[model samples]
Target: MDDEYAKLIRRMNPPRVVIDNDASADATVIQVDSVNKPGILLEVVQVLTDMNLTVRKAYISSDGGWFMDVFNVVDQNGNKIRDKEVIDYIQTRLENGANYAPSLQETVDALPTEEHTSIELTGTDRPGLLSEVCAVLAALQCNVVNAEIWTHNTRAAAVVYVTDDSTGYAITDPNRLSTIRELLCNVLKRNNDVRMPKTTVSSPGVTNRGRRLHQIMLADRDYERVERSGMGRVDDKSSRPHVSMVNIERDYTVITMRSKDRPKLLFDIVCTLTDMGYVVFHGMVSSGRTEAHQEFYIRHIDGRPIRSDAERDRLIQCLEAAIERRASEGLELELCTEDRVGLLSDITRVFRENSLCIRRAEISTIGGKAK
Candidate 1:
């Protein structure tokens, strides 16, 4: 009954967003007022990120079942937002926060009704692994539609969307899919012992492909440190995340985190916590040019603080893994060209032959152009 009442209240008082360009001389200021709810903060931030806006500064306050946030945001060039169309879109998206604006991810993930076959794979990180997988897919008449790959901590995870080369749609043949799985499994198993490679074909749009990558790496235990010696080893301690938790007033667990700031850092932390079934009741975030700091007063859904040291340690490990998995490393590279059936295969093969390792990559093709 109480939950229903909360929903009624939320509907009665929809979010209100006020965009004021004159509020700040350097950046546009956006203020949002709404009924407080779990994950509301994240939803607001996600909107700004989808529009590719950089948040220069923010003031967040949600208390007594009310949420009021003000953000100073700018365009990619760090200039104030004055374009009327973009301003209107931002206001519309923010006012209807529950229905989020579609990001590039939605396009990559394709349709939610199984327009493509989604593949999830994780295994030991090594050079030419991506090439090998691409080669095998090309051989089996699978067209790579869109894919996202991330490598860290001697582990790799990839979520790939593919369709039948002949039909340009999801592959439904059980026999052919079985063959594809068997061959890719063989390729992934090669030179992998730390953790056996997992390859599973799931329906498209079952989960957000990006967040699924985070979950995949976390499940593979990439947060736990290992020896750094091989070619893909990361030795940067400065980018490492610091996470600690303490009890406050014997009522809530106060989690404080500090690390080098990057885009989507807040979303990553909040997503991980929500996935672990914790709710952030109160929090603060401050992100500058180089570093980011966040503090959260959280509790389990059952309304209890952390029960034991083991739980605290495990939560810390998961949060740390979340930060490192997305760390920016390696040489920046770009490839923009026409999209084709065997293009990914050929490109990855050349990368392998040249001994170049791809630490992270975002693959997409639109309007006959692959990038």
Candidate 2:
């Protein structure tokens, strides 16, 4: 019987949802593990919001195509939701499918007013950067009207236009404005700027810095040559990835990724390929002052160049998504205060009541203070 179930699970790959009662706490805990896809987190949160349940603490992590997320949730009045039927309903909804479209009634009833506001954010890029910003805005009930993002010199800058979803008004509340500024500053400043790490060059030819300079020169020369040959378009922005095939006595495709210099970028790209079941044969990685470029000669593990147009397009899409996710995954929030028994849980309960979800947290105490 166990073996049969195991085989069934392998074929289905279905999401697993578990709701566990926390006797020591006022919030019920829910855990979900599933094959990760875009918008999965959003769907879960939307369902909870629609049910009028408040999310107090959440931990979200995705490795390759698998994700695990845990949420602490409570009723709108900050009471534990212990009713068995309700619990079963919630679990069923989460496991049923991702096509559940939430109603707009909650947004309409949230805080209706009319205001338009603009905010500018600049910081080092990381995975999930846009998602984090958008999540913050969503938590605050701010609706994005328009936004633009650009990356250059290892920095990301965004200009956002938003309006209050409830009231359709600009964010004029001083307290809300202060909260927005503080939260965004935390997200932007907590991580180091995305730049190449220091390294030693034992190569007989040149030092690391000298090699980087040469790579930049080579990149510039190649750009000019491409323009002269009329094979590629020139743009005013920093470089993006260019993927193509090799036709001359080689059975591999080449992927050229050029972006603002970032740490562990190659690791992220490699992980994406591994997830897609591809194998790398030969590769070259180089860095410029504020940019990095990588070229990989690769083929499917079954030893075939990506041939189908659909598969090639998916490869490019997944690579871009992986890079973007890595660039934005540095979002975090920090707290510091005096410590006491049950203080941490008490704080989390408050966040839950206020409808603020904590995706992840690190806590420690020093000098009689909790941080």
Best by TM-score: 1
* Tens digits of lDDT, candidate 2, 49-111: 546675555555553457677766767677788788678777776886533324333321122
What are the TM-scores, per candidate, against the unseen true structure? 0.89, 0.31
| C-alpha local distance difference test of each model | 0.81, 0.54
Q: Could you tally the backbone clashes for each prediction?
A: 0, 23
Worst 10 residues of 2 by lDDT: 199-208
**Cα lDDT for residue 30, candidate 1:** 96
Tens digits of per-residue lDDT, candidate 1, 232-311, equal: 56577776789999998778899999888877677677778877888777777777789888888888867888999999
Predicted model with the maximum lDDT: 1
**Superposed Cα deviation of residue 27, candidate 1 (Å):** 3.0
Q: How many backbone clashes does candidate 1 have?
A: 0
Candidate 2 Cα outliers beyond 4 Å, as residue runs: 1-250, 328-371
